[model samples]
Target: MVEDYRTHPNLAKIKIVLVETSHPGNIGAVARAMKNMGLSQLVLVNPKEFPSQVASVRASGAADVLNDAQVVASLDDAIADCQVVVGASARMRKVSWPQLDVRQTAQLAMETVSADAQAQVAILFGREDSGLSNAEMDKCHYLAHIPTNPTYSSLNIAAAVQVFVYEFLMATDIKSVHQAEGYRHQLASAEQLEGFYDHLYQALQDIAFLDPSKNARFMRRMRRLFNRSQLDVKEIDILRGILTAAQRQSNQLKTLTQDRD
Candidate 1:
């Protein structure tokens, strides 16, 4: 009873999020691994194959974690409530994120959850084959990587989950490092961020700045820049306001040009 009292609360604050997982067996193994380390609260984001015999068999004795796992449609939904989100990736991206070693990430998790008892932490794992997409990485506040041989860095999804969960369990002497202290507004949620992006894109189009045909990756690049900035709720509103003004001005200019012609 004393053991349960000590670990359960902290463990409850940490969410293990698997995004677009392809295999059922890996999901089962991940559940088993989390249970082994006194962690739970698994969230599956759009798993291709779930609730299969393969996964259930791989789960072995830790079926409860699998049974209780929450399934969500998108990565954003999976981590919408989390204040601190760390994504696991081995491959480097064009857009730089605050990179952290696995141990550092674990310590950050400890500090974040400790500082605000209500604080939620999400550790996101990408697909089994390709790892996390660039868009997915943009959603994270930090990107965590497990050190591996330069020649071969690929790790199975389940194995990767085990490594991070182990680090989280072993983490000690955690100290809070406060960032974004001066920012008045709270960090924007995934849904809020997406809305801002949509507004920006539409405004750019209305102003004849973004050519939809030729600018497929333009928004992705913009996402990288903003993701690094970690824009807050108030900041998002400010940007959207600028976009609305730009769009309105563009429409007025277009009407004047048509009348002149």
Candidate 2:
């Protein structure tokens, strides 16, 4: 049974997600790549056009993946239950975020998924032209960068999927003694993490730290910072408690000032 399961490592964990794919051909190609690597979980978040004949033709023999693909309204919806999210990018952005090579990211993901039976790992690919936006990238716990020719680093979405999936499959084959021991820390659930962000945001608002007018930009940056940290459940709980305390203090201070006045 283990061998059978190992044969389809992608089936056990790992969701291949494409966000806002503009081309159906890329979608089909991604499906083909997933099928090639024994990956069946293909998720498309708001594709420009899906179920197109062009996609089917490009999919070649991987029509099953295309047919079974989950179409979600947003990237968050696609990876809501996922424990680990790795975004693929070819270019470096203005923001300095932690980066991982494909192999390292795969190893981390495999470790995460294997440790927790309920864990769902998501590998996200952005639009073909722009790649993953900063917002989309912020949603991921880690960033996976493919080492291509610097001059011509533009990789097709399907090609990017192939690289990551291949590494993931290879990582799964290795029976590590460490994996048997399980993860050292408990990673926060998506819901928990989101709640922490909410509390943190509210605390910032209460303290007048984040300008209400620029709240959107401020929250976006904060999200990216926290996501990159990949906080565990304990870490998130601790942070939430801290934020709660800060909010309470801020409220108390406001009350005292008003009473004094």
Candidate 3:
């Protein structure tokens, strides 16, 4: 039964979350959209209206999704196990945050989800009027923006969910085929990658290559490059080992110089 359910090429991780939704109709519509894309997990955090007849009617045949949907008190509780969180935002903000276009965000989600079986991925949609607040967006590791007309960028909540979920389903399908064919690359888990980054950063600091006084500007760029590359588990492990060896060599050299002096 598990194999049968997972045989679909588009199958991805769980926990699609909607936050602060004002309209039950939109919630139902969003559930329908998720089912269309073969996604089943749905979470609602502090919705304005739920269990409404309007939502059930709008869900049409996807009423099962609504019936099984989890209602949470807070966003943190909803996404606690998710390693990768993608927040959809229509408007740009003054403060800087990591952003990914829908396509790229979908790819990252697939990579992260497939890397570890236990890893959860979340796609967060905000309320209709304002979209995600800065605090809510900040909770996400990455921000996702859909490409739309500049003249009129107003997308309904259900519509936005449809666009993102479509991209996600497509990307997951393509990646799954490539993976089955042994043609796709793998990526390290966030925990593994973070450990590698820490070792690399420490090695660079020891060599004076990374200036401590500069406030990690260069380190951030290196992080971006790695994220774009999507290094696999083996790749990250190998790199971390190399960094460790280099650091050891540097320490040995320092000891030799001190003894000679």
Candidate 4:
């Protein structure tokens, strides 16, 4: 009966995304790893070499996963529809994201899927050498890490994906009570959040708050704030409405000052 976990419907809602992978073989390896763990959704963002024979050869029997993998031009396009985005990282950034361990990340993924059928969870793996850039990480709601030796902690990208895939399979074994079925609202997608952030930034600039060149990290901090909140669609609309109101007020004040001068 435990083998039934292989056919779990929620697994289909989880997307494993690779960002700018340098080696085609690693993509193939990740595909194989995903298939082995009963997860199939794979997305590649700007891989250096793909649709290559090397990848097909490495995929071995799991060529089906490779064949179906989505190739996208940018990280945004890859994760635009996902409601929850988690970045796999080895090092913490200066502006720390809420970090999750491998097992916890799988739990979060499962909970998100259990809550909403339309929602997708994207687990992002970054470049082999640099991992995810600051910009890519900004799109993530959380950063997840595999516990490794503090002295020597780097992992091959495929290996990290395998670890996560295995954990995701293990997550299926948990009792159904742990599922987050109580969450009823449709959580905001990554693209929607990006739009709201842009509006909020423009409103900030309209009121003479943010200076992008000088205070570049300001928006990053703001992203961290809203991302952790896990805003829903309606919440985003409300916040954007507030920003619009503020922007309109700022414009009217500026017009008044100009008229007086």
Error of 4 at 223 (Å): 0.7
Root-mean-square deviation per candidate? 3.8, 3.1, 6.2, 2.0
lDDT of 1 by residue, 107-183 (tens): 87876665555667899998887888877886787888888889987888888989998887776345455433532
lDDT tens digits by residue: candidate 3, 176-198: 34346564444455556567777
Show the colliding residue pairs in model 3: none
- TM-score against native, each model: 0.78, 0.86, 0.66, 0.93
Worst 10 residues of 2 by lDDT: 1-10
What's the CA error at residue 162 for candidate 3, in Å?
A: 0.5
Q: Write the per-residue lDDT of candidate 4 for residues 63-149, one digit (tens) a residue.
A: 999999999999999999999999999787776788999999888888777777798999999989899998888899999988889
Residue-by-residue lDDT tens digits, candidate 2, 46-112? 9999979999999999999999999999987898888778888878777656788998887788767
User: Candidate 4, after superposition: displacement of residue 84 in Å?
Assistant: 0.8
Number of the top-ranking candidate, with lDDT as the measure: 4
